[model samples]
Target: MKNYDVVIVGACTAGTYFAHLLAKEGLKVLVIDKDSEQNLCKRLDIFHFTRDSYDQFDIPVSGDGDAEWVHDFDLCLSKSALDNHPKKSHTKVAVMHLPLFIKRLRERAISAGVEFHFEESFVDVVYNDQKQVCGITTTKGYYDARLVVDASGIPSVVRRKIEDDYIESFEITPRDKFYVLLKYVQLNNPDDKVELSTSWPYYKGWIAPQHNKSGAIIGVGANISYDYAYKCMDKFEKAIKLPEYTLQYEEKGCTPYCRPPLSFVTDGFMVIGDAACLTKPWNGEGIPSAWVQCTPAAKVVAKALSDGKIATKEDLWDINVLYQRGEGAEYAGTRAMLIGAVNMSAKDNDYLFANDIVFCDDDKGPNPNVVGTLLKGVFSGKFSLGGLISLMSASNKGEKLKKHYQKYPESPAGYHKWAKTALKLWKKVGTMADTVKDA
Candidate 1:
C-alpha cells in the first residue's frame, strides 16, 4: 500500500487547506477528491471571507478579492420599529471568487510537494489491530497513512464509518439544512453593494456585487426543499424589483445550518470542516469557519507529529479543547440563541425585529448573541420589560452552553461524562424551524 504522513479523504477547502499547511511544514501529505480537477468547487455561492482572515492564513489574494475593500451591507426587516424596524450594520466583510481561491490553494499545496488524487471516492477506513485508524481504501485503490482526516463535507463518510465505540458521531438532520439558490444577473440598480433581509425561520435573500461589476449575484436561502427555495428566489427577485436582469449563471445547493460537534477527535483520526458542522450561526456561511476550525487542527496535528508521535486520541484531544474554548464555544451558544429567537411566536419575533432586538446585523459579522448591544437596543427602542426578559433569557441559555463547551474534557478520561452533560443541556436548546414559514 502507498503511504504518507496524512491521508485526507476529501480535498475541499478544509482538507486541501490543512493538507497544504502540513506539507509546508515538510510533512508528506496526500489529498483525494471524488470530483475532477477542472470541476473542483463547482458549487458556487455569493460568499465573502474576511480580509483579516486572508492575511491571518497568509493565502495570497488575487482578482476581485484584491479590488477595493468594500463593507456596504444594508439589512432590511420584514417589520418596522414603531411604524418602523431595526437594522443592523456589519463590519470587516469582503468578497472573493471561491473557485479561483480554492484553485490557488490546491496549486500552493502541490507546490509544497503534496500528492493529489482526484476523481477517487472514499470507500472505507482501514484499521490497525488496536482499533486505530491506519489508512483508508478509496475507489481508486488502497493506501496507508499514519493519520486519516475526514473532510468530506456534511456527509462525513469516514465519520459515518466509525463503529460508534469511539467518538460519538455528529449527524445533520433535514432540519439542519438550508436549501439555497444563487444566480449571477445583470443588474439595473446603480448601487454597487450587497444586502440581505429576511424574516425568521422562513425567507432570506441577498445581493452581492460581482467582481466584474457588470452585474451582481443575488440569492435566496430557505428552510424548505430545493424546489421551494427555487421558487422562493422568484419572490426575492420580485421583492427587490430586480429590473429584468439577465441570468448569466445559477447554482442550487444546500448548506448544513447546524452547530459543530462538541468533540470530533479520536485516536489516529480527525474530522473537520463541514463534516464537523462549523458554519457560522447567522448566515450559515461555511468558508470562514472552515478555515478557522481547520487552522487550529493543523497546528495541533503539526505539534503532535513534531514529537515523532502518532496522533492518538489523547494527542489530538487538544483540538476539541481549544476549539470549544474558542470558535466552537461561541458557535454553540450563538446557534442556541438564534434557534431560540426563530422559534419565538411570530408576534414576538416581529416585535423583536421591529425594535431591532435581534438579527439586526449581517450573519457574517462578529458574535450572533450581542447581549449588551441587544439589551441597550431593547431598553431604548421598545422599553418593554417582557422584551428585556426575553433577550436576557436567550442570553442566559447561550452562556450556559458556552460554559459547558469550555469544560470539554482534557482527554478521553472524562469525555463520556462531559458529552452526556453537554447533550442533556443541548436537548433543551434547539429550534422549531421545522414548523415555520413566511408568515
Candidate 2:
C-alpha cells in the first residue's frame, strides 16, 4: 500500500490550498477528487474575492490580463427594502472565473509537491486499533497516511463516513443551506452598465459587474431550494428598480448557512472548508472564511506530525482553540444577531435604514445609542414590538455565545462542558431559515 503523511479528499479550493500549505512544510500530501481536473469548481462561473485576501494568504493576485480575472470594483452598496436609503462600503474586489481560479490554485499545490488523483472518490476510512483514522479507501485503491483531512465541501464524503464522538456527521439539510441562483445578463443601454456591486439584503439579492463590460450578474439566495430563490428574485425585481437587461444564462449552487461543528478534530483526523460549515454568516462566502481556519490548522497539523509522532486529539486541539476563540467567535455572534436583525417587516427595515440603525455606513463604528434608538422606533410605531423583542433577545444570545467561544478550552479536557452550554445557546439563537415563512 502507498503511504503518505496526509490524505485529503476534495481537491477544490480548500483541499488544494491546505495541501499546498502542508506540502510546503515538508509533509507528503495526497488530494483526491471525484470530478476530473477540468470540471473542478465549474458550478459557479463568476465569483468575487477581496484584494486584501490575496496578500493575507500569500496567493498570487489575478491581474487584468489573466484568464481568471474578469474585472475589479471598489464600492459595494446595500439598499433598504424600499430602495430609498443606501448604505455603502469601500473595498477593492477582484472578479474571477471559478474554474480558472481553482486551476491556478491547483498549479500552486502541484509545484509544492502535492499529489493529486482525479476521478477517485472516497469510499470509506481505514481505522487503526485505537479507532483512529489511519488511511482512506478510494474507488480505485487504498492509501495509508498519518493524518486524514476532509475538505469535501457540502457532501462531506469522508467526514460523514467516520463514526466518532468528536466529529458531527449530521447532513447539511436544505434548511441548513442557502440555495443561490445567478442570472447572467446584458444591459440594453451602455449607460446602465454595472461597474460595482449593489445588494438589496431585504430580498437577499445583488447585482454585480461580470466579465462583459455591458453585462452583470444578478443573484439571489434563500433557504430551501432554487425554486424559492427564484421567488425571492421576483420579489426583489418588483420592489427595486433595476436597469433593463436580457438574461444570457443562469447557474445555481448551495452553501452551508449554519453553525459549524464544535470540534473539527479527532484522533488522526480533521475537517476544513465547507465540510466543516465554515462559511461567513452575512455573505455565505466560504473561501476566505475557510482559509481563516486553514491557516492555523496547517501550523498545528505540521507540528503534530513532526518527528514521526502520531497526531492525537490532544495534539490537534490547538487548531480548535486558535480558530474558535478568534474568527469563530466573531462569526458565531454575527450569525446569531443576523437572524433577528433580518426578521422584521419591510416597513421596519426601511425605518432602520432611514434611521442609520442596522444597514448604515459602519466605517465610523456603530451608533452609541442603539438601544435608545430602537426603543424610540418601537414607540413611534415604525417597528413592531415583537420584532424589537426578537432582535434584542437574539443580540443578547449572540453576545453570550461570543463570550463563551472566547473561553474555549485550551485542551480537549474541558470541551464537553463548554460544548454543552454552547448547544443550548445556539438552540435558542435558532437559524436564519427559521425566519423564512413557509420555507
RMSD of each: 4.6, 1.0
Candidate 2, residue 78: Cα displacement in angstroms equals 0.9
Mind giving the per-residue lDDT tens digits that candidate 1 earns over 199-291? Answer: 323236665666546577777776647777777776655544444567888877778876676678887788888888888877777877878
lDDT of 2 at 277: 95
What is the Cα-based TM-score of model 2?
0.98
lDDT per model vs. reference? 0.71, 0.90
Deviation from truth (RMSD, Å), model 2: 1.0
User: Over 4 Å off in model 1, which ranges?
Assistant: 63-92, 189-202, 212-214, 231-248, 307-309, 344-356, 359-393, 435-439
Candidate 1, run of 10 with poorest lDDT: 75-84
Assess candidate 1 and give its TM-score to the true structure: 0.83
* TM-scores vs. true structure, each candidate: 0.83, 0.98
Q: What is the lDDT of residue 394 in candidate 1?
A: 66
